[model samples]
Target: MRGVVLHAPGDVRVDHREDPTIIEPTDALLHVSATCVCGSDLWPYRGIETVDGPSPMGHEYVGVVEAVGDEVTTISPGQFVVGSFFASDNCCANCRAGYQSACRHRVPMGSLGTQAEWVRVPLADGTLVPTPRVPPDDLVPSLLAASDVLGTGWFGALAAHAGPGRTVVVVGDGAVGLLAVLAARQLGAERIVAMSRHEPRQRLATEFGATDIVTERGDEGVARIRELTDGLGAHSVVEAVGTQESMMQAIRSTRPGGHVGYVGVAHGVTLPGEELFYSHVHLHGGPAPVRRFLPQLIDLILDRVIDPGRVFDLTLPLDEAAEGYRAMDERRAIKALLVP
Candidate 1:
């Protein structure tokens, strides 16, 4: 089988690798149909995060179950499924409390990168949610989005308490941030303010439900948000980019009593205690417990309540994943979907 491997920084290649098999009773093997590059993947690709020899790439995936271990029962071979970026036992205390991302038994899916002809899924019953049916070809990208970006965006909105009568300020214009705008609208937000500098991304933000676009950065961006909100700041804010500056912007753009739902993967950054103390804003974020919302998100997709797949403006064969990385890194594409 062939899988995407990162030999070193800026060097990604399609290489022959041993196929995966069901190694645990709760495991299942998937014939990957679709996958996509994530913003976090760029951390290693850009040399911000170090990588050792040939590390497998990719995490988000939607595919058909080819096989399942003896213990896996809810899902059977031939069923189409969508899973979160991480594997978790849904029965754990944290999972039962709607925090499956922190399940006692959790596995980072990146360790088993889904960008391949086949991939192994652990905790199949808990992680893989079978779709109602095999969707049409075009729906694959939308379903795949549910595994990560869309799910993360939804989590961001939820964390920030975005809903009817609230104003949502979204920081970052990447796929996840754009999806955050979509999520905020679906959650009943009255107005959405998106901060972006790129014309293409700005257009997409409006199409996704943003009521206003602010093409400023740092303090200037926060000022624009405050001005729109009558100096009180937005009622809620979503931090989809995990950099120090973006996080600060999200925090500063939110009202004192409001919340900030952050979904960006943090990298070598720390928060200032005094600043947070003075802000009086609620902060909550980590990996999204997407499994908790999978059932509802799937229903929305099946009913066409939202179209999350628009984030993938570019598509490529699995063998050409390197181009996907380059396009995203160069800001030429919002996201690149891979068809295996």
Candidate 2:
């Protein structure tokens, strides 16, 4: 099989690799139908996250089950499924509490490399969510999105406490951020503010139910949000970018008693204890427990109630994944879909 391997910064290649097989009774082998490049994948590609060697890349995936271990009963071979970036034994205490991302037996799927013809999924019965029916070709992208970005965005909205009569602000205009805007609307946020300077993203934000767009950055951006909210700041703020500036902007743009849901992979970020003490804003975020929301998100996509797949502005064959990475790094694409 062929898979993406990150040899170094700006060096992604499709190389031959050994195929995957079920090594554990709880594991399942999948014939990956669709996979994509994630914003987080750029961390290693850009050297923000150090690479010690050629590492396997990609996590988001939707595929058909080709085989399952003896212990995996619920998910049978031939079923189409979507799974989270983090695989979990959904029966764990944390999973029971709706935090599958922190399950006792959690495993990062990226390490298994889903960007290939086939991949192995651990905790198969508890981690993979089967679709109602075999999804059509057109729905593959949307189902694939649910595997990660859509679920993450939904988690962001939930963490931020977005609901009716509340004003919500979303920082970062990437795919996850845009989907966060969509999630906020679906969660009943009365007003959605998306901070973005790019026209394409701003347009998608509006289409996704953004009531306003703020193109400013740093303090100015916070001021704009404050001005729009009558100096009280937003009722909830979603921080989709993990940068120090974006995090500060999210904290500053929320009211004293509001909540901030940060989903961006934090890199070189440090929050001053004193500042946080005075801000009085609630902050909570980490890798999204996507498995917790996979069922609902999958239903939404299957019902055609939401079209989050619009986040993928570029598509490429699995062999051309390097170009997909370049497109995203160069800001020429919001997200890239890789068809295997």
Candidate 3:
């Protein structure tokens, strides 16, 4: 089989690799139909996250079940499914509490790689969510987004306590951030402010339900958020970029008692103790428990309540994944969907 491999920083290739098989009774093998590049993947491609030699890339995926281990139940061959980066046992204590991302028996699916013609998925019964039936080709991209970005953004909205009569601020314009704007609207927030500088992203954010677009950065961005909220700051803020500036901007943009749901993959971020301690803002977020929301998100996509797939402005064959990575790294594409 052919799969994407990152040999080093800025070097990605689709190379021949051994095919996957069920190594555990809880595992299932998927004939991948669609997969895509993630913002997190750029961390390694840009050398910010070390690439230990050639590493298999891609995690966001949707596919058809080709086979399942003996222990697997509720999932069978011929079913179409979507799964996230982390596979978890839905019965675990954390999973039961709705934090499947932190499930005691969690498995990082990236270790198995989904950017290929086939991939192995563990915790099949708990990790993968089947669609109502085999969906049409046109629905694949949206279903694939639910596997990661859509769920992540929804988690961001929930974490920030976005709901009726509240003003929400989203502090990133990437796919996840853009979708966070979408999530805020669906959650019933009275106002949605999307922080973005790019005109194309600004337009998409507006389309996603952002009532205001703040193109400023740093303190200026926070000021704009404050101005829009009548100097009290926003009622809630979603920090979708995991940098020092973005995080602080989120914190500073929220009212004293508001919340900040941070979903960006944190890299070298540190908080000033005194500042954070006095901010009086509620902070919540981590790798999203995507499995917890997969069922609902899948339903929404199928029902056409949301269209998160619009974030994928570029699509490529699995063999051209290197260009997909390059396009995202250079900001030429919001997100790139890879067809296997």
Top lDDT model: 2
Clashing pairs in 1: none
lDDT of each: 0.93, 0.95, 0.93
Pairs that collide in candidate 3 are none
What would you estimate as the lDDT of candidate 1?
A: 0.93
C-alpha TM-score for every candidate: 0.99, 0.99, 0.99
The regions of model 3 sitting more than 4 angstroms off are: none
TM-score: model 1 vs. ground truth: 0.99
Model 3 TM-score relative to the real fold = 0.99
Q: Report per-prediction Cα RMSD to one decimal.
A: 0.8, 0.6, 0.7
**Count of steric clashes across candidates, in order:** 0, 0, 0
Model 1 C-alpha lDDT per residue in residues 79-100, reported as the tens digit of each score? 9999998899899999999999
What is the C-alpha local distance difference test score of candidate 3? 0.93
Error of 1 at 258 (Å): 0.6
